[model samples]
Target: VAARSPEPVTPSLSFPQRREKIERRQQEVENELKMWDPHNDPNAQGDAFKTLFVARVNYDTTESKLRREFEVYGPIKRIYMVYSKRSGKPRGYAFIEYEHERDMHSAYKHADGKKIDGRRVLVDVERGRTVKGWRPRRLGGGLGGTRRGGADVNIRHSGRDDTSRYDER
Candidate 1:
């Protein structure tokens, strides 16, 4: 007799359910981040002092476009855009490496809040390897972006056009 395999199950979540799920995941990451030690990681890449971590990138944004946008600050060494290994699609974020740390600093300060491909990308120095007790947004410890809807959502991570509060006359 031949046995049939069970079908895979996929659950569609409501808005609040998705929010709850995100909260739980964030909490788990928070706990894990507390014990993380970047020094022990053997697979670390890039020069932290000269690299800038950019997030909220548009998937359609290309490396050349990114380069052209960032080249204003200084000479760039590389642009490493993150992509999904399973799907091979852009992951909406990237790391831009500059030839000098001073260039990185300038970009880190001015590149943030600039629109790229119609999305305002968030820029921060590569603090994962340089700063102590630093946790990435995936680990729920970064200064920008969160699924939790609260008062602070508009505080540190306020750069997108939708969140801007310019006076309308």
Candidate 2:
């Protein structure tokens, strides 16, 4: 048996190199998103059932890190880290696709609130695109939001079988 060495982390690179790498990864992800029309792509249908939506991820976390963290449940197919187009930086969320729907559900059950890269991430069954009439956090809809001294109208999971909610009310 042999142990595998961890992949090179950002610390191994000089500051300038790290910045460039991050920018490049962000650009790549954003460009892929721009070209991906999964809703209409027949190839993406399986992803809807076998994907876990992970939120509140650490901004610096990488895809390999996420795979190592989540693969305990089962084999992973892919990881899609979301990024902001204008900022060209991580958006603190990602979609983890598993090779099997059962694996996806297992991750949804066990990975929520699990610490990753020093941050506790939220995990849920992917819904925004699969569920009808569901909206993301940007369009005034999301699973959860913190109170900012306004009307207590915060909603998350919205009675839709979410268990990892960090509700502060």
Evaluated with lDDT, which candidate comes out highest?
Answer: 1
TM-score between candidate 2 and the true structure? 0.60
TM-score of 1: 0.63
The residue pairs that clash in candidate 2, if any, are: 143-156
Model 1, runs deviating above 4 Å: 1-44, 144-169
What's each prediction's TM-score? 0.63, 0.60
Compared with the true structure, what per-residue lDDT tens digits does model 2 show for residues 60-110?
Answer: 999999999999999998888888989989999998889988888778768
The runs of at least 3 residues in candidate 2 whose Cα sits more than 4 Å from the true structure, single-residue gaps closed, are: 1-38, 41-46, 144-159, 162-169
Superposed Cα deviation of residue 168, candidate 2 (Å): 29
CA-lDDT, candidates in order: 0.77, 0.74
When superposed on Cα atoms, how far off is each prediction in RMSD?
9.3, 14.0
Tell me the tens digit of each residue's lDDT in model 1 across 59-162. Answer: 99999999999999999999989889899999998989999888887897688889998999988766677655556657755656443456655453423223
